[model samples]
Target: MTDKVSEAEFLQGLIPQLRSEGYEVYLHPTAPVVPPFLADLRPDAIAIGKGKKLVIELVTSESTQQKKTRALANLIKEHPDWELRVLVVTSASRGNELQVQSREQIQNFLDEIKLLQDSNHVSAAFILGWATFEAIARRLMTATFEKPQTPGRIVQQLAQEGYVTPSEGDFLRILAAKRNALIHGNLHDLPQKGEVEFFREISERLAAESAAA
Candidate 1:
């Protein structure tokens, strides 16, 4: 298997991806102001589009959690828009323990964002890790397919029309779980042969669903 990409490069590439996907993104590298002072906090990167804004803070060091907390504090102070989103980019070596810890931290951050939204300062909030890009992409694609008027929904409807086996649906769910594991940086124990077979099966099922539709 290939070595994981560095977090810095991943964030760099991810910024444009977000832009292309119609999200406004910003990078905040330093805290904007001291608690007792009033000043405009400069973020590392900021993109504004799609009627919303996203603030990104990239950390490559072992102290990623600390850095994220600090950046989030500054973002709350500087941005008045209630619909702010945050992205945390770090290496997989940080391990699952750290990942769980980060999720807790992100939950708190989401709470703050929701407060802003409740006050009509923003619309929504999101927290994403750079390592989870592929998984996120899959989810976005699936959402698109599931939309009422999309071809994906049509394919699913056709599958139901043909009374496809419930096991087929179970297999798709399993594939999604495996993809989720890989995206969350928890695939170190994944069996290579099983993954290959699962992918092949999913591909064939998807094709059949499309044909039936």
Candidate 2:
């Protein structure tokens, strides 16, 4: 079993990463909404934002394919707004084999995301392993600023337009710090506490902006 503290810390970091990419995220011990009678229902992470919602059920113990299938079905029914994704982030210490397995899982998950996106059930979904963290962060942040303008530039423009606050400007800088950590593999050196708080603050501001728009 993986250390609970480490797992929690990892998930904590994941929240800001998703938020920086413009996702409204939530945490849950089980499917956020489901019929009360269904036992053994849980998902490690759940996030909703930007025209999409997602449920990520992480498998950490011995489980049957049938069980997983059933849970997935119930989850889909419960949160129709969410595109469902499953991941098994293993503690397999073997390097090459672990990498191969993770890649296969992620590819399959991406395929599902594409299918959902095409069907209009969700904007996208992704199943990720620990090693893919950096790649995922980079992709999400990159997607956020796909226009001809950089994120910093966009933020500055928005500030000039009175759409973002000076505090929001500082939050954007915090995002830059997180991005740097992702790119440099220095997550330990990243400002964990401030990054998360600032991310939430900026997300709230953006949500208000979106609502007003």
Candidate 3:
């Protein structure tokens, strides 16, 4: 991003790149159609592709910590298909705070996921299990961009290239759709025991491969 460009210009600049990557990028208009809960907190743009809805927010380092930003993250947290991509044009804040987990730490997380399933915490297991699957996809994926790609995009690319089997990819997408419902303030709907266990199996396999690599 050129330092001379304004936020709008900066965002407009990304449209071609985003579109080329298969995202149907929609720049801000008078009214962007977001969920009712997030109607007031409309993002700078919304990118839809690969079965995902990305809430793209352009923020400076200082504004990243503001109340609205925090609210945006919290509100978007529950939805599996939605992600908040914070594009910080400035480098003033502490750089990427993503933590690195050791092999043992990764194993612990895998164990916790299975434990959740064994304890009959299906909701917790399903959510964490999906997150773990997404996390593994992020680490194992070879694709790169100026910004981090959302998990849906990552999985889609992998599935396209045969890194993930069609059946596996389809199953995950079904679970993801079910998960979207579970998060929108709906707790009554939950995945079955077999589904949660399947997540555990996939997560463990991916974790092992990642560790080996």
Best prediction by TM-score: 3
Model 2 scores a TM of 0.35
Q: Candidate 1 regions off by >4 Å?
A: 1-5, 23-40, 59-82, 92-213
lDDT computed for candidate 1: 0.40
All candidates' TM-scores? 0.33, 0.35, 0.50
The local distance difference test score of each candidate is 0.40, 0.46, 0.63
Q: Please, what are the lDDT tens digits per residue for candidate 3 over residues 19-115? A: 8768888777335367766857767788888987777766442232335545666676667677665554433233333333445655655665565
lDDT of 3 at 46: 86
What is the C-alpha lDDT profile of model 2 across 1-213, one tens digit per residue? 344554465567678777876776666645434324335665567776778766655443122343453446454755556566544344433322222223334333333333433343321121222222222222333443333333456556556766567887777655655554554445355444434444444443443444344
- Clash count list over all predictions: 18, 0, 0
Alpha-carbon error at 12 in model 2, in Å? Answer: 2.5
Tens-place lDDT digits, model 1, residues 1-213: 111355546667767667676865544444432222223444446566665554544433233344444545545656455223344454565442222223333334334434433433321121222122222222334443322232234334434645335665455445445545644445354424444444333443433333343
To one decimal, what is the Cα RMSD in angstroms of model 1 from the true structure?
15.3
Candidate 3 TM-score over all chains jointly: 0.50
